[model samples]
Target: MNAPPATRGGSALVVIDMINTYDHPDADLLLPSVRAALPGMRRLIGRARDEEVDVIYVNDNFGRWRSHHDELLAGALRGPHADLVAPVRPDGDSLFVVKARHSIFYETPLEYLLAEYGIGHVVLCGQVTEQCVLYSALDAHIRHLRVTVPTDAVACIHPDLADAALRMMERNMAVRLADSGSTGLFG
Candidate 1:
């Protein structure tokens, strides 16, 4: 509810599933890749803030029925990669959207919120590039929102699958795989 609700006809950055505990089955393998993405993600976040672009963190609720955003954040801070969590943590002005599914727009108020904010374009940056990020991008595309995925800002569980997912998004969803600095949406 922060940041004036929406920026309609503007751009927003959705950080998906990054506030994770990394205690899942594939976590060990995914942690390193996710860490590698921190720099890019941080850079993008900084740019978004500087440009006054909406920074929306669409995180998983970790299946906790009553868990709130702050709780999820605190849990992640206590997780293995607290360093990763700290630098990209959402600020007071940032928007938070708690989701139970992969896609940010799935059964969530993301679509409605974006519409209210007048966000016609979205730049997605976060973990599990092949899963949540991919699904969210597709959902955005279908919703007719201009989608941009900063390649370096998204992490993956498997390199091969991640690459394939990027290609699929590019070809099918018309996603643009770019560097965080070149996203252009911020400027």
Candidate 2:
């Protein structure tokens, strides 16, 4: 296997689509997996912070055009599943990028931010393994950035699709698939 991102170049732990309200459709289907994955996500976040690795949260805007990071976070915290949101909440120093679509790079400043940070590799963790995570991996690959996805840190609405997506990422995009503990997120 290739060396983890931190050894290759600057790396950031990118948390995708996790700050959610759980008020949307399929949220019920998504919650169980989110709960299952929450501990791993927390561990990864803590590890990133301890290692002084940049931790960036890239989340959907929930169609609230004017909403920013704090606003979206506040809304989620007020929702029914605050327990789910609390453990993985972004710290004050965490970088936040608002995305309007599935791919984190689509119409978002993430690519530029990554460039500004000299980030050549990104370790992605969060929800919807088959959708946002999958697409973001592709976009990262196209940008010539190395990608790593921790199997335990990503939650999904559908297990079969998520498995297929993970396989596709590893096979097609050259993404490193690992458990959150072993991903060498900080290298």
Candidate 3:
């Protein structure tokens, strides 16, 4: 497949489904991985901000149709794992997009937002590498956006599935697989 035309604007860091309440099924299984990935996520977010890159958080809405970004954040922060949510909480300047399903772009304004920002590349991070992250990467790829996923920055419920997902992303979508400390990630 041909690459999408490059945009003049720089890369954006897209945080997917990380601002979570962890109240659902499989939460127990996912928590350990989330804990392990926290530091990497923190580093990437810090670097993205330091580099003046747009930090866009695209999260699942948990079926709260009337809720907004702040509400979702507040709920997550109030959950049992507030410690986890606090470190990567969205700042005042961070862009927020609410998603209903697996893919960040599904029925969301993310495509328009990226276009408005002239973003041609997206660095994806956050939970469920085999699910949300994987689907989001595919969506970004088809949309012609260059995709990157820092392996260490994504959490997964099942390690084996997550590994397969990462490999699929790299092989099929041409996604750049890097660690959170990789330089120029936001370039």
Which lDDT tens digits does candidate 3 get at residues 55-149? 99999999999999999999999999999899999999999999999999999989888887788899999989999999999998988888999
Local distance difference test scores for all models: 0.88, 0.91, 0.93
Candidate 2: what lDDT? Answer: 0.91
Candidate 1's TM-score reads 0.94
Candidate 3 clashing pairs?
none
Among the numbered candidates, top lDDT falls to 3
The better candidate by lDDT, 2 or 3, is: 3
For candidate 3, give the lDDT.
Answer: 0.93
Alpha carbon lDDT at 51, candidate 1 = 89
Q: Candidate 1, which segments miss by more than 4 Å at Cα? A: 1-8
- Model 2, 1-187: lDDT tens digits are 3333354578899999889989889998999999999998999899999998999999999899999999999999999999999899999999999999999999998888888777888999998999999999999998889999999999999999999999999999999998888846655
Write one digit per residue (lDDT tens) for candidate 1, span 1-187: 4233234468899998888888789988888888899999999999999989999999999889899999999999998778889999999999999998989989898888888788888999998888999999999888777889999899999999999999999999998789987846553
Cα error, candidate 2, residue 9 (Å): 1.0
